[model samples]
Target: MSEAPIRLLIADDHPIVRDGIRGMFTADPRFEVLGEAGDGAQAVELARALLPDVILMDLRMPRMDGVTAIKELAKLGNTARVLVLTTYDTDSDVLPAIEAGATGYLLKDAPRDELMRAVHAAARGEAVLSPSVATRLLGRVRAPADPLSARELEILRLIAQGTTNREAAARLFISEATVKTHVLHIYTKLGVNDRAAAVAVAYQRGLLTLDNG
Candidate 1:
């Protein structure tokens, strides 16, 4: 006998985006569009009511954001796996949603087949990430194994504190060029692209602490 279609709840603030996602899922026999939510609060309400197998969540929404909704679902002991479907791929966006119990993260631009595959994987409680996101996260996962040097960590902490290269150089008694090199190395070791992402990832990975002022 054929298996039951995977039930889905799509939550996005934009009507067109919602329509597109709903149409895509409804066109496939393997999936069913159970409901659509325009904002995170409504998404949470629908999720509690419909109990879908997976929720395609958009991060930037009204009333509440996707990350907050994911956290709420977890607090309520909702079993549905959340698959973040948003335009954001930054460290701040990706890490918080995952830490909040998202089963997957996929960009809004993902191909239909890939999105389908992600939904299937999420329904099975498997973790999924977009290629770019996976690459960034993989760097983070492998970072602890390689470990950052002491100088790199010092520069990273200064970066986290909003220090410019020149300022960091002065603070550490190093040349500006040396500080810039250390910053780049810290970025490489943390699997991030800039000062903000580096700081965010560092906090996520426990490489920096809250009380380390």
Candidate 2:
């Protein structure tokens, strides 16, 4: 007995790129290329229809872009994990794709083996990134700057303690607007756009301690 091959959709504007990816996946017994689309709109439609397990998406495409496609797919409740395959390694491209719910990012020049590994990882709901992209993400995360003020740190401590912003503001005797400002500052300080990341950073840096009572 054997496990079924992972179904995949390849979405790229270049025929050569799509063909190359198709070849690579076909070579692996664990993967099956179920469909291919040359643009983002068609990709979205095919993904909705086919419901592939993974989507290999290129960032720049005609009619619609990969970021928009990823967002639209998520909005439509598509469960396929999008794995971005692009030539661009810039923060602008990477961040937007991740924010749009892409599960992975890989360079166009990635070796066949790495691409295969990324495909499998993305299929399992894991985030995969090239080493350079990982370095960039870590650099952003570790930059030493107290983007949060003293007041913001206090607010973050409360937040980590599971306090709502309104509750934190009430406890601290501050306005909700002031609490929001502190939260925004905390996000900036941690170089993260969300509360989960901010909390993780605070916990990692010993800025937030847990009471396991």
lDDT (CA) for every model shown? 0.90, 0.87
Name the regions of candidate 2 deviating beyond 4 angstroms. 144-213
Clashing pairs in 1: none
* Consecutive 10-residue window with the lowest summed lDDT within model 1: 138-147
Q: Give the least accurate 10-residue stretch of model 2, judged by summed lDDT.
A: 204-213
| Candidate 1, residue 142: lDDT | 68
**Highest TM-score scorer:** 1
Q: Report the C-alpha lDDT of model 2 over 1-213, residue by residue, as the tens digit.
A: 999999999999999988988998898888888999999999999998999999999999999999999999999999999999999986667777887899999998899889888988998999999998888878867876565667877888787778988999899999999888888878877767778778876765677778620
* Best-performing candidate as measured by lDDT: 1
Q: How far is candidate 1 from the true structure (C-alpha RMSD, Å)?
A: 3.2
Model 1 per-residue lDDT tens digits across residues 16-88: 9999999998999999999999998999999999999999999999899999999999999999999999999
TM-score, structure 2 vs. true: 0.68
RMSD of each: 3.2, 9.3
